[model samples]
Target chain A: MVDVRYETAFTLYPYARSADQDADSPARHPVVIVGGGPVGMGMALELGLKDVPCVVLDDHDGVGVGSRAICFAKRTLEICDRMGAADPMVDLGVVWNVGRVFRDERQIYDFNLLPEEGHKRPAFINLQQPYFEKFLVERIRAAQAEGAPIEIRGKNRVLSTESYDDHVALEIDTPEGPYKIEADYLVACDGARSAVRSMLGHDFTGRVFEDNFLICDVKMTADFPTERWFWFDPPFNRGQSVLLHKQPDDIWRIDFQLGWDIDRKAVVQPEYYMPKVQAMLGEGVEFEPEWVSVYTFQCMSMDEYRHGRVFFAGDSAHQVSPFGARGCNGGIQDVDNLGWKLAAVIKGEAGERLLDTYQEERKHGADENILNSSRTTDFMTPKTEIAKLFRESVLDLVEHTDAMRPLVNSGRLSLPCVYDGSSLNGADDAILPQRTRVGATLADAPTDQGWLIDRIGGRFQLFTVNTDFKPEGLNLDLVDVIVAPDDLITERYLGAAEQAVYLIRPDQVIAARWVNPTAADVTAALNTAMGG
Target chain B: MEKLFTANIDDADGFYAELLAAHEGLSEAESYALNARLVLLLSNVVGDRAVLTRAFELAKQAG
Candidate 1:
């Protein structure tokens, strides 16, 4: 059994007695999110902001120990930005866009992830997972103070769950005792080894890699540039790969690929891994070990995200290898996708069938993340001899030629998922850029009224550019932009067309777009977007 | 999208001889590595994904 009461540095939500403990019947909540990790907290914050009542039950009081998921992608940052929690994260994160790939101590090539300009957020920022969760909780508190119907019950772990036709009943175990509660919707934002998933008897079916990776967060004052350094095979760790990244504070995160067989217990000790860290940092480097963990990853996901009223999000829904930093990033995206849909369903703005689109769209996203992560894993730890031979050949070719550099697979960094061929998507204008097409998360650009994304509040919007064509009888917010001829917004949203109209979803995903769309077209698209 | 079966190589026999000659003095492992590298290099040359996919399917079928 997994230990739910793991100690952490911060106690953001210590257990407290609630009135529900003495209630005659179970308290009914609009949404009950299990596991107060980033996704759950983000879900609560999203629902709370939408005036949807939610209760979060977490086993632990606060953020977990260690700088677990260090890389927050631009898309994740944008999602957090919409939740009013991105400012502190970006302010304290170690921003980086360049990554260098090396093979056997020789630098092959360096890559710039975000080569284009006009984006408000950088390509990625390395922040500790604890701080990320803390910021979400902080935002949750801020929202709660603003009369948002959100409650977090710490030390209240769900022991069992029973799904019914109308609602899902949960039996939670707290420090005091056990209590019963019912929710219109139950979201399992629990981690990969989700107890709720076990209670529900759902299994994640995917390939589990035999290789184990040792993650070490070292605290030291080093002058290493804030860039992701990946070594395929180095002298210190011969025949193995190593990844080094700079996190906030004086902490540096290093991942060492340990072969299939290892003493899991002994390897995490300071004596076993510190020498390896010393060797990698050279002879005279002074450092202190912060957190050490050995983990074997699996590229896995549940077959479905929504099971009746009980939904699965984050690591509970799907899990990818840590190579591409897709774990928590993808989880946050799940929260972003499901949040508005759940809120709309609760508020009677959308039909219950709208929730099924969450399964359709996010399952597609999970597959995409799994495909990229599995490819990276296979390239990193080639199970077959032929695969290893090709991987080595690619590394060899990178030394002398620029053509082979793109083939190097350290990790294809996380990018936003565009839901192509989604059921929720509507009419697409072929004249517009493919990047901002229907079902795509709207690309950010600088506009006259601050950043374009900042102006896209969490609501259905009729986003227009260089046009005054407003659809009649539609009660939607307008993100009207009158920009210069060469504005970045125009370049991103309006390609060959002189003017464009886009129906944007609450989660900032484009539902439909047109060059000259009538009101009936907008109504049809909106209806389709809302699961009509 | 050109089909993989298209006879595009001007000197098929010469190309076959050249390919084998590239791995003339290599050990078993080295020959395997060479073949892998050649596959990668040629795959880049045939950058069209549709053609590459068809080539993969045809090669798999032959085996």
Candidate 2:
């Protein structure tokens, strides 16, 4: 709700002037991240945890309302915990594990993200983005109090940016006026239409979905499953699919499908929407629609995440269908991946060439996510009439065939991305873990429940059994050896001891591994990846 | 086939209720073990094994 009385009361709430006319060195930050969205704030928190100096820019006056991108995967929560924001976030959000799909107003199927053998956080959490951003901003403030340089410029738009050999120069347009800022590197986390990326002429290429979608945020005053309830078909809505999720404080989120033919503007009305809501839910349930928006998704990814010292992340990098809640979560993973690398390069721990691999590996993952979403999106929007009949045929078999259950439910949509080829990743132990590599599960990598995320610790661990020896060419700082077991092996890894020697990268993907391995094999893997 | 991941969520309340029913014999070791598996699963979802490994070890030690 826009308070026009209060908003008009304060006509111009401008930013503070650069009070230090005599302060030397305008390069106040090692890295300046553009766009203060989740990805940007994520990058800021990652850098802040590492005691890295950075400034985050956003043109928004405050964290906007309407609850965008509420579903976050488990990996995102881990990163939030690393930044000391997960507890509050988890407290503020709802832990959702079950989803029920409806067909013609009958409960068709129900799937649980059933807690697996190993998972600390819940499968997903439903929290509005504004509160989420507030959590991160608070963490940024706490980091600033500790003397870690983190300046957040509200209403600061990047007018013009020019990157030199050693630094990035950005002209930020504050309310007072425009001012120039310099930094060692620039990380752009701007949303879909990124001005920074546009200025740099970076091409974002991918397929665009033809169907339009209406996202609705509402206060449900009725009885509905507290889980993520969806309807492939509701009787009142005829053919349009509905994606419903419960938000914080009795609010429910509904993403209504508007086919290629519907008018974008005219479709939003109490007459049109109320029927859709009453269709899935019986007549008595009432809801006050908080925010209604019309949007269409594009399956696109940026060709590059970096140009010289300037970097692109989040929506600026790639986009996917909200089907699996991968877009925002994957973007946060990018920040986790780039945060350490950016900090390391700035601290001179590795060459600047290491920065190039960010585009390579992350872009690859981004494409994978888009493809995954596209597959689901295609399944959702049956193009041919025959295909629609086939989908119906499949849904028909859900109760009859055990083999068909996996087909109908598709179980969990979250799959760990495999890093194929990148300088940072050596590429032997890709399948060693279940999910995101740069996150928390890497064996033998360094970690503390402190500021530096799971990614910031260890020089990649080469988990090897010392018995099967081989030569390794030395002098590479990125390689750390973890002897399989000096009596503490079996309890450490449930995987067989022969599968030892998993070389974990700094981002924590199993870079390479040798079974019953040797020193030479480890060295070769490190040499191939580290170029040492 | 050994289940890489398992969910007793099939019967929702029954599963957790069963765990609560067995609370009399539940040891601290069992609790830690549960926490470890949970941490490991969550870490895998997030795709960070470093924390997974740490939590895994801590769970075993506590056990």
Candidate 3:
């Protein structure tokens, strides 16, 4: 059990004294979310923005306990921007791009993620997980205050769920009492140890890494640079790897590799961790231990994320090692993918078959994250002598040669997952550059109205570059026509062509492209894109 | 198709030592890049598609 006595740094939202009751008995909602965590709140906010009603049920009354998931990638930041929460997150986060790797005391190579910046958000930001959840909750509250139909019930646990053909019946347990509610669709964003998933007996398949890591969040006034620092087999931590990341409020997160086969609970205590931390930071450097936890990495996922009217997102659907910062970042992408589809279905804008595409697309995303994370973990903690030798050779070679820079893998970090073989993808007959490919995420560019992403957001966009073509006798209500007259936009999108057009999905993924598309061509593509 | 460059160098040990020495001070990336350049150069020198294909298949099998 978590220590309830531990005073949280952020606001501990009070559990409502009353239970959620139905005035007409067994309340019905458009959507019911089982967890009120970051992913759940993200889904709520995403749906709320689309004017879809949703109720979020969580057993906890506060945000995350520890400073978990410190790294938020640029793609995640962009998604948050759309949700009306990125500006404060960017402002509060420690923006960074440079990452350095070292073997013993010798530095291998340092890399810059974003050498050039025409985009709005930075490459990466390091904010504590509590703050990320807090910001999402705030967005939900602001929306609710403005009369948006998003309700978050704290200390309300979902005891069981009954899935039907068209709706789901949920038996929820609250502090007050137990109540039953029905939802058009049920989303389980509960967590890694998901109750819903276990209740359903879904098989989570993957490899569990043998190495354990002890994460220590320390608050200190140190002059460490705001770049990711990774050390392999350092003198202080013999035959182990160490990672250092700076969070907000002078709090630094340090992870030390504690080889498997130790008491996990014992290693998390300050007695076992402080000695090693002191050896690295020196005894003179004053510091206070904020939080400590021991964790073993696992790369696992379910075969399917959707089961009839019930859907799983975030940790419920999949999990990856924390090395690549893919866990929470990829979860946010799941919300981005599912939010629009769920809302569209609820609003009767699209067929229920559209929801199946969520499982198909995000399964691809989960696989990609798992593959990359597993590879990074293998490199970081090699299992055999031969593997260690190869790692050592690669690290040694990265020290002096610029050509070997790409070979150094501390962590590849997180990038947006492009829905490359997705069923939603339409035909691409236009001869275009690789960046503007049909299945790729829309490349952001500078425009008169802030940024390119800001303009084409939360809607099916018919983006035309250096061209004036209009769709006639078609339902244009579902699509927004965006005209980019900027030279950079034309250069990046149209290349040397006089005009080009692209059908962009609500999540800002290019569905199809045309050199000179007619109304008939766009209508057929959009029909396929809508899963018609 | 045949073992075209079969243990052709008389001082094989010396050549191996020199090869290792050449990569001693270089970074892992640099050594790999150098090896890639060397492979391209040697491939060009062979100037035969079938020989290059055979060399690739043999190297892969050995690996």
Chain A TM-score for each of the predictions: 0.98, 0.84, 0.95
Question: For model 3, what is the error of residue A408's alpha carbon versus the real structure, in angstroms, after optimal superposition?
Answer: 1.9
Where is model 3 chain A poorest over a 10-residue stretch in terms of lDDT?
A: A1-10
Compute the lDDT of residue A476 as modeled in candidate 2.
Answer: 34
Q: Name the best candidate (by lDDT).
A: 1
lDDT of each: 0.87, 0.66, 0.80
Name the fnat for model 1.
0.00
Tens-digit lDDT track of model 3 for A446-496: 776678888776888788765677778766533223444455677678776
lDDT by residue for model 1 over A190-276, one digit each (tens)?
899898899899989999998999999999896888888999889988899999999989899999999998999999998899999
Per-residue lDDT of A1-532 in model 2, one digit per residue for the tens?
Answer: 1122112112122345564222454544688888777888889888877778877777765566668788877778876876777887888888877878777767876777676533446656888887777788777778778887777766777888888888888877766666677888889898788888889888888888889888778888677768877776676666768777888888888888778888777767777777776665667777788877888878877777888888888888888877887888889889867887777777777677777877877887787787667666765776554445445655664433333344443213554466654565443443333332322244322212322234333355544433434345554333223333332333343234444455655555556664554567666676555433
lDDT of 1 by residue, B8-53 (tens): 5554333433544565567778977787898899899889988788
Worst ten in a row by lDDT for model 2 chain A: A1-10
Model 3: pairs clashing at backbone N, Cα or C within 3 Å: A397-B27, A397-B28, A398-B28, A404-B29
Which regions in candidate 1 have their CA more than 4 angstroms from the true location? A1-4, B1-63
Candidate 3, lDDT over the whole model: 0.80
Candidate 3 regions off by >4 Å?
Answer: A1-13, A17-24, A475-487, B1-63
